[model samples]
Target: MTYKQEQLSEEKVFKDPVHRYVHVRDRVIWDLIATPEFQRLRRIKQLGTTNLTFHGAEHSRFNHSLGVYEIVRRIISVFEDRPHWNKEERLLCLCAALLHDLGHGPFSHSFEKVFKLDHEIFTQKIITGDTEINRVLEKVEKGFSQKVADVIAKTYQDKLVVSLISSQIDADRMDYLIRDAYFTGVSYGHFDMERIMRVMRPMEDQVVIKSTGMHAVEDYIMSRYQMYWQVYFHPVTRSAEVILSKILHRAKDLFEADDFTFKLEPTHFLSFFRGDVRLEEYLKLDESIVYYYFQAWQDEDDVILKDLCERFMNRRLFKYVEFNPNLQMKDWMELYTLFQQADINPEYYLVVDSSSDLPYDFYRPGEEEERLPIHLLMPDRSLKELSRHSDIVEAISGKKRTDHKLYFPKDRIEALTDQSLKKKIITILYGQGEVEDVR
Candidate 1:
């Protein structure tokens, strides 16, 4: 069968918690799902390290990837019956959705920051490089793999198809928001996805929601905002992330130290420590392998590395206090000095984590990260910007909100021999004991 006509004898169905059932009809998609690269997602958590805070967040990328593919499949099926929709791009959209997140490494946020790596770069490589995924794409047709990668990169010529996969409101975000909420057991992520999809129309270069479905769309945006602060940006989740990033930084530094002997060879991290990780080497690294190294490092001679690993493994995350690092530069330095005197190593202990987002935005000229403003297709056959119509989104549109927190291991500081230092630190963290502890 030709790529356009390829199909499984019987459609394959995977019962999903978020999308009900993910049905796969194309042979290429079926084969791609069985590849080693795609299967690797099973070992990587969807929300890395969030499991330490919300224990139910143990879902893997594999689950979310499949959900994305199913969403795109359903969208394509609907688009097929509408005007301006092309049937030729059917398989292309599905494959792109399925493999978009294929190259994410273990604890990607920390690993990417420490190693200066980009999972998107590796994603394109896996699709275009010499891998099982590439081999399967080549079977469908030569050059099919690059087209899929370009869709994920948002550089593809078919803007409608690209928007369906990666635009501001696309299959990827829609799937994760719902899927993550389901696993995290949070109520903020609930929205009318079915109604939103019904109103989603394929425009010349983007997807626009019908005015009749404005409330559903509004709910989706609010859900995204709620999910961001309530679940994705939870302080406890950030606490685990703080320890994770420190562990990676400490390990990289220790690797550079003279005659550093690792009880367990960091076979997966050698190239990363040297700042040159090849695609093949990167594909070998996963959550399991990373955790194994952390377990081994707990027995290492480096106290920081050992302690950080213990903190991560034992769920002993750092406590955080709200602080504007820019305005409190002097306060930050004082804490740094205190940490050093207490032998806590401020470099790893005193961490400032920032989470920022513009709840909504209109297309602005010459901006770095420009998001296409949400457009509502009015009954008069004219388009209106979302913020102009919705007061809720307007109040927050183009207004960037940022939250800063100073993270430190309270237990370590409290263990200091000097009672005065502990009292000062407590005062700095919470003046007059505002709360018993930082959750």
Candidate 2:
């Protein structure tokens, strides 16, 4: 039995702040988005804790999926008559780009950290499992769903298809860098995307930028760097994550001791706490359901649960300062002991935040996860690795930057009943004086 491709009478469009309008021409793509599993993405925030820092970033992955599909569609439109560009690969690329993040769970990073679940696994399930997305893919062909999954999994033998969605400069990154920047209301996303698209040429196995468009590529690389530092790695976001991780830890502890009762459903959380989670149960969990529990736990008998929930809900983010992991180990221990003495839980109050990213890594022999380095098409029709041709990419290539921040609740510290313990903790956290930014 074969499913017929059904199109809406009038083309359906989603009004997006980033892409303006995402057009759905194919019935399969439209049906995939309408599925309950896909619709759940609308409830999950794209930037998670970033909403507390940038109020405008209240968008969701559903918006991003559409944006990615549009970008890939535009790319495919440009390469329709070009050599080495297969028209048959069009739908596969579009579907892969649109569903690249389909597996992302609620509060993605925090949920992953607590449950030890990888979103990529869920993404494959959504595409191949007994879901509407699978039904839609099967409409294209019997094994079309697996092909789509392969593209996202980066195991598709067609390097061209894989490069379109998973490469360093693929539609996924191209869309998110711009979408995230636009929603966060930052200027760093102002790269010449039109120019980049214009210069993109499909090769035998990959997409290469025209040498004439080298500057645009450089601008893109720099924009990504700035966005990472300015938005993606913001200390405030990490602070919120730290608080959330501790909340999950405390909740698990309480559940184990039977020391607390949940007023709402923690169905998804129970399996995670017990180290066993089924895929179907995992699918039922979303950010809204998790947040509902947080709201209800606000009035719980456990003081720790109540405080953490209040902190997360009210945007009372933890205060952060530069930290030296080795040098501060002693100070950290002392601070923990001091918190115990002051009746404050050091386990929740003290946290170390760290983030690292490789701006532009060039291909090297025998490296784990060898990146397919970006290439520039020379006028002579030869390809050159971007780092070899661009001084800027060369300078930043293989260079990884890391930031460490010590996070604590400054508000509670200032109100400490034990003056001596407070003084010690203050000295350890902020170095021997009244903390300046104690909010």
Leading candidate by lDDT: 1
- lDDT string for model 1 (1-439, tens) is 5865778889899998888899988888899999999999999899998888788999999999999999888887767767888888889989999999998999877678878888898999999998999999988888999999999888999898888888778899899999999999999998988888888888888888899989987888899999999888888888888899999888888789887878787888999999988888989999999889888889998889999999999888888778886788888888788788888899999998999877778999789877888899999979999999998888778888899888888889878889898877777778522432434
Q: lDDT per prediction?
A: 0.87, 0.85
How does residue 162 of candidate 1 score in lDDT? 88
Candidate 1 deviant stretches above 4 angstroms: 432-439
**Candidates' TM-scores?**
0.97, 0.95
Q: How well does candidate 2 score on lDDT at residue 61?
A: 88
> Which number leads on TM-score?
1
Model 2 over residues 1-439: C-alpha lDDT tens digits? Answer: 2234456679988887767788887777887788888888898888988888788999898888888999898889889899999988988888898888999989998889876888888899888988888888887888999999988888898999999998878888888899999989999876988789889999988999999999999999999999999998888878888888888888888888855677664666888889787767777888888888888889888898899999999988788778878677887788888878877888888787789888788887798788889999999998999999999999999999988888888888889877877777777766733333523
Stretches > 4 Å off in candidate 2: 1-10, 432-439
